[model samples]
Target: MDKNNNAVELRNVEMHFNMNKEKLYSLKEYFIKFMKRELRFERFIALQDISFDIKKGDVFGILGLNGSGKSTTLKLISGILSPTKGQIKTYGTIAPLIELGAGFDMDLTARENIYLNGSVLGYSKRYMDERFDDIVEFSEMQDFLDTPMKNYSSGMVARVGFAIATMTTPDILIVDEILSVGDFHFQQKCEERINKMIDGGTTVIIVSHSIDQIERLCKNCVWLENGKIKMIGDAKEVCDAYKKS
Candidate 1:
């Protein structure tokens, strides 16, 4: 495929995590083990030679069971983590809603967090100032603006995160199951916003346990199992196969 036409490309990607074999209670004990060369590690593979391509303006879904490395893949694409092996190339700016409230300060009010999260997402203070009202409106949390995020419910937090992340249309949007936290009505609102972004030419990568949602929003889907690609192709076909299995 043409490079310019693709929004994301992953080639032979692999992710490995090292698990410590022993726990030390203190720095002194940890130093003793290091001096003795007694530190041991076990390697766990999270993704194995995974390869895929997402074209510009496409809504792609990653379907997998728990521990299937779907979240790992998204982290790699978002540059939150590096793959142990292989290359990932992305075109355009990214807005990641992978972890709700990851950029929030619990002690800060919701009003304060909007700018905080906006800065983390690469927007300047002046830019966030311009969009503050729009963000608050979309979040429907104007009443709670002065309330600390720590006091907000999970769903409320998710709403703020979603609002900030989608306040502007990015070239690529990555979402990871956060929509499930919202009530049915809010989820609908979010889905509509996502759909609008897609129509405006944003490429979206979503990881969801909801097969119905994957089929409804994604044109192409990949099924991951045991850190490998189990199936990839048209969303309906792949999802149907996964359902049967």
Candidate 2:
């Protein structure tokens, strides 16, 4: 596709993490080891030279098993974490549902977080105020709106997060694995909303382990393995190949 038609573009992206190669029993042991020049570190590459294009208004899918860097890719696009190397370009506003409580403050009440999170997403006060009721209604947390976010269950936090992210159509909507944490009813409602956004011409990127869901919603898919892209093409074709692997 042409560059003008792309909603997201990633080029040679790589993410790296430094980890202690060996574990010490305690700080004292670690100090002793360090003093003896015995400490070792490993440079782990979570994503290796990833590159892809998400077409405008398309439902793009990322498929991989655990530790394949699916969530890391989303974070780079969302601007939550910068890429250690390479470049990422996004055309418009992005709403990201990457993980549970990712952008929320634990001590803040649900009511306050609605605004807080909205602000983080670049929504103005007036904008969030207009959609406040809709957010609470969709999440079904009206009763606990005053409760601190730390007290909310994982499912409840996921509900609120999804509601705020999808309250209105964003140019780029990125969803990770948070939908699977919701109950069946919540999941159904969320899918319905996603379908609505699709009709409204929103560009969506989804990372899911569910092949069926990917086949149903995505037009193009990328499969990653061992921090590298194993395949990229039609959703069904990649999913079929993934099942065999």
Candidate 3:
């Protein structure tokens, strides 16, 4: 890697989706049209020629309205979904807390699910074992550790999920709409943990509509509109621009 290269980079990336054309053709014509028309399927553009870079230790905030592709942008960065065109590069490990309980198995007990979630985040079983107590204490699920995750309440599940996602100190952390999940006290604790990670030089990318939280937590921000870059600068300036319009 070049000395000046960023930790995260996107070079003119684009993402698009194709709609089904099954209903548009007859049974016999379907076979005939499948080979010819499938290549020309109707395209819906989700991201358009987007490009950005984040250096090490940069707390990058993504601010956009609903359907502005904020979540999709995070997905791209985390490698959950690939861009149709262009290039995306990340130097270090990424921990994406994109959705609450995303990798969880409802049928599994909380203790078992801890191992599963940690594995999904790229940690070995031994590593999870070492951090097991910290995870359980942070989640406050000591009483329900043996219970199946499906039996837990939404708030309880959020606690476990958030704790599992943050078990390992990742080099890059991507959070999407996670701050509004748990109770006020839990939210405060999570915020403190995230701040500690940032202080330790972790690159953080936050996708949220809460202008106040973004302003308080982020130093730099990017505004995305209609799958394109709208603004990129200081957090307050970009957030103020987003709130007014």
Candidate 4:
């Protein structure tokens, strides 16, 4: 692929999380130790030497087991987390459906959350005003729009989240295990919308545990194991190797 055609470029990316050596039971204990400068931390490396390129309009799959850094990679690409070492460059606008309800206030009504979440995603009030009805229609939560989001079930929240995130077609869409939350029917609807976005030339990076889903949706795949790239190639080839391992 041509370098200029790439939507995302990650070069030797490394992420490190600093974990406390000892867990403090309370704020008082934590503050006491902090004043004394006796607190100790252990560094945990989540990803190491990760390098990959996702071309514009490419449907890319990030495959890995639990704690293998797949979600971390998506977070990095979404600009939610920065690499401890190396460089990450993204070419265009991004819509991230990483954590459902993450941008919402549980106390707020679903209708209120539409504007709130839209703002978080960088959409202007005027833009949201124009798309509000469409968002409500797509989510199928018109009746519950006035109700507090905390009262809605997980599936309902997922529906609203997916609807709001996909309200506008972004240049790059990042999905992390969101399809696993909703019911089968809603999942299908979400898939169809995603397919429409993909057909419109939106680059998508999806992190899914389901090999079947990855194979069906993604053309290119990357397998991450123990924070390192194990394989990167055709989706079917990588998924087949992952299943065998």
Say which candidate scores most in TM-score. 1
Q: Per TM-score, what order, best first?
A: 1, 4, 3, 2
Rank ordering of all candidates by lDDT, starting from the highest: 4, 1, 2, 3
Where does candidate 3 have its weakest 10-residue lDDT segment? 19-28
Q: Compared with the true structure, what per-residue lDDT tens digits does model 1 show for residues 123-191?
A: 999999999999899889989999988899988999999999999999999999977878999899999
lDDT of 2 by residue, 104-176 (tens): 9989999999999999878999999999999999999999999999999989999999999899889989988
lDDT of 4 by residue, 44-133 (tens): 999999999999999999999999999889989999899999999999999999877679999999999999999998889999999999
Estimate the Cα RMSD of every predicted model relative to the unseen true structure.
1.8, 3.0, 2.5, 2.3
What global local distance difference test value does model 3 have?
0.89
lDDT (Cα atoms) of all candidates against the true structure: 0.93, 0.91, 0.89, 0.94
User: Which RMSD does model 3 reach against the true structure?
Assistant: 2.5
Model 4: colliding residue pairs: none
Where does the lowest 10-residue lDDT sum fall in candidate 4? 1-10
Give the better candidate number (1 or 2) by TM-score: 1
Model 1: residues with Cα > 4 Å off, grouped in runs: 1-3
